[model samples]
Target: MTSQSVTPASAPASAEPKVNWTILLLGFAGMVIGQFMAILDIQIVASSLPQIQAGVGASADEISWIQTAYLIPEVVMIPLSGYLSRLWGTQKVFLLSCSGFILMSVAVGLSGSVEQMIFFRAVQGFVGGAMIPTVFAVAFTAFPPAQRVTASVIMGLIVTLAPTIGPTLGGHLTEQMSWRWLFFINVPPGMLVLFLVSRYANFDKGDPSLSKGFDWFGLVLMATFLMSLQFVLEEGAKNDWFADDEILLLSVVTLVTGPLFIWRTLTYYNPIVELRAFANRNFFVGVVMTFTVGLALFGGTFLLPLFLGRVRGYSAAEVGTTMVVSGLAMFATGPFAGRLVRLVDPRVLMFGGFMMCAWGMWDAHAVTDQWGFWEFAGVQALRGVGVMIAMIASQQVTMSTLPPHMVKNASGLVNLFRNVGGAVGLALLNTSLTTNTALHMSELTQNIQNTNAGMQGMLAAMQERFADSVDPAGAAMKAINGMLLKQATTLAFGDAFAMLAIGCAFAAFVTLLAKPVKQQPGAPPVASDAH
Candidate 1:
């Protein structure tokens, strides 16, 4: 069937419908802003968690729940959003999500206890998560073919840029004002988005009839499975994986419910999420690309700040400053990447982008405690540009070939994959850092001996430096151990980066498996059927 045949009659007239650009663009812009705020909240507290913990009287361990609580509900909501929007109408869902998010943001900001904070954050995340996939769906379906590249660019920039700059912005806000400002900051922009979108967003009407046989059980199963899986991924490393009782219990829940959820989704008359989207080969490959992009995007962002804070003794503000280079690089490269996507084969762009990311990660393998802003500038820039490029191309590959009716469901699945990839990447990287550091420390300790000249020289120098102390020898031994730990940690970071480099390089080769997309003069890029 032709693309137009599958589109609902009540939906927009065509995939590239001839509509008033002014109103659509305004509404779309507002949606994009809403999405930015939603995503920014994900990591905005990353640099200011300690301050938040102090304000809420939370312990070191309880403070982490601020982020984890948000993420768990967010992950569950993302895929369900497609059905939600279809059942409730895009404009209505968007408006409700925007309003609820704003309210929760306020509640979170006013929260006096860690319990209150966690509850507010979870509600905020559930509502805010709806905005993300909705924006992606609107970007591909609302715009004409000619504007899709530009739309992709805007979406790509926001998706990657928000998380990249979140920590930086959060640090500045906390340092200049207070940690509460992180949540309160969403208010002004959010209000503007709510106004613009309410007046201008008029794309699709919901069919309440679709709710007739809505599988409520399936919804419960999906939520249970996703929430359990997310909890496992988020807390697994910190709790030492399945060893912790709570973690092992959740792991069993995830294992049991995951397959059952999938089976129910496939067998039910109406599934909460569209699993059939994976049947499309092009979409499948694109999903894989986006997954890898997530791995690099979140992985790189996670690694740099960690190394800076732990290894370099940088404060939150200092870490933010050093990491802002990547954000700037992404902002600079976005428009150019947008323009280039239309001219080059998307696969080519994907390949080049992945290669650049790989190169950046490879260069980072030389990281030391002395490395700072200037040291990371080139590496961050490469990653910034590479991720932006790869993201745009991956978006095209995922959505360009799908029928207009399938776009909404496919968009949810596409976003879900990326987030899952990020969760997995973070878990693996955290495990690597911990395990590798211990391994390296053990080896270094074994190699350093009293008989070794180098060890003797270092110990003698340390003893001389502490000559005024009564226990100079003991101080020297402690100093030497600290030095070894630092060196081992640094080596572990290098190994993580190297592992990321290899993954990106592998993704570059996988790009070749995707069908080449060719753009016609006034038509959308079509996926070749040759494969």
Candidate 2:
């Protein structure tokens, strides 16, 4: 079936048959803005960790829960959106979700203590998660079928840039104002969108499938599996891995809940995610790419700042500033990619982007203790450019490959894999890093064969420097140990990047199987006839 198309001037005012293009654009813009708020929080809180920790007297674990709470709501809500939007009109869902997000964000900002903040932030996640998936459904359905490629590109750019800009905006706000302003920032933009959403979106045309009640069994199983998985990743090191009871409990939860959730989703008449979407070759492969990309996305978002802060001694603002180069590069490449997607097949772009990202990660892995700031920044820029090319084209290819009616299903499926990927990526990276530390330390110790006086004196100096932390004589011994610890961290980070590089490369290889989409007459690779 041909994609739906809307025209404003030809329609009778009474039909309100379709929103005027101008009104629609405003709605689309609002959707993009709403999405920005959710993605930004992913790392903005990390940049403000110190300020937040001090303000609320929070421990690292407590601060973590603040993020976890927000994430849990979003994760649980995202996959259900396709079904939810169908049940409620799209505009109603979008407006409601946006409103809820802004309100919860306000509540989070005003919270008096850690408990208050965490509770509200979790609420915020529910709204925010709904916000993102709906944006995809809205954008995909609003444009004509022929324009999906172009629309996807515009959206691809925004999704890429919004998260990228989060750190820059968060840095400026956190440094210039209170941490609350980071959240307070969402209000004005959101208000504008709420108005625009009322004017243009055909909430009346929402999907008809959501008449079913809540799928409690599916919800419980999925929530248990994902939430428990996230807990294992974030707290694994502190909890001492499988030996810890909590980890063991989480494993049991995953083992029992994950398969049950999938089974129910497949069997249900109106599954929240429409599990059958995976039947499409393009959509299925896209999910795989989504997972790998998600991992890189979340892993890098977590690792870079931590690396700079812990290893290189950079402040939050400094790290945020440095990370901006990657975003900027992606912004610059987006328009070019939109145009390129039409002329070049998405497979070419996806493959190239994967290779480039891998190369960039390999570059990042090369960082040394003495490396200058510019070195790190340079590598990030390359990664940023690579990200735009990979994500933008992949988005188009994934959706374009589907029939018009299946677009929403495809988007939901894509979202689910990416979120899962992000969770798993962090856990996998953390494990690899932990393991690498031990191996590297052993190797480093083996290389110290020179028992010369100069080396001995330097080791002695190192020993004296660490004396207070260990014992007097133990200082020298522990000094070597401390140096080894730092080196291990370095090696671990390098290994993580290298693995990401390899994984991204494999993702690109899978994407290469996507057949070239025959261009529709007058179709551009990336066009957004946004009102």
TM-score of each: 0.94, 0.89
lDDT of each: 0.89, 0.74
Cα lDDT of model 2 by residue, 306-329, tens digit? 777777877667878877877778
Q: After superposing candidate 1, which stretches have Cα over 4 Å from the reference?
A: 1-17, 467-470, 524-531
Q: Candidate 1 at 353: error in angstroms?
A: 0.6
Candidate topping TM-score: 1
lDDT of 1 by residue, 1-531 (tens): 144466677776534455687899899999999999998998899888878988999998899999889989999889989999889888899899999999999999999999999999999999889999999999877776667778889999999999999989998899999999999999999999999889999788898988899988888888888899888988998899978999899999999889999999899887888788888778989999999998999899889988987889887888899889999999999988887787789999999999999999999999887889999999999999999999999998888878888888888888888888888888899999999999999999998853688778988999999999999999999998998999999999999999999999999998888887757335544331111
Give the distance in Å from residue 255's predicted Cα in candidate 1 to where it truly belongs.
Answer: 1.9
- The C-alpha stretches of model 2 lying farther than 4 A from their native spots are 1-19, 207-209, 212-214, 446-450, 460-481, 521-531
Which model scores highest in lDDT?
A: 1
Q: Where is the poorest 10-residue window by lDDT in model 2?
A: 1-10
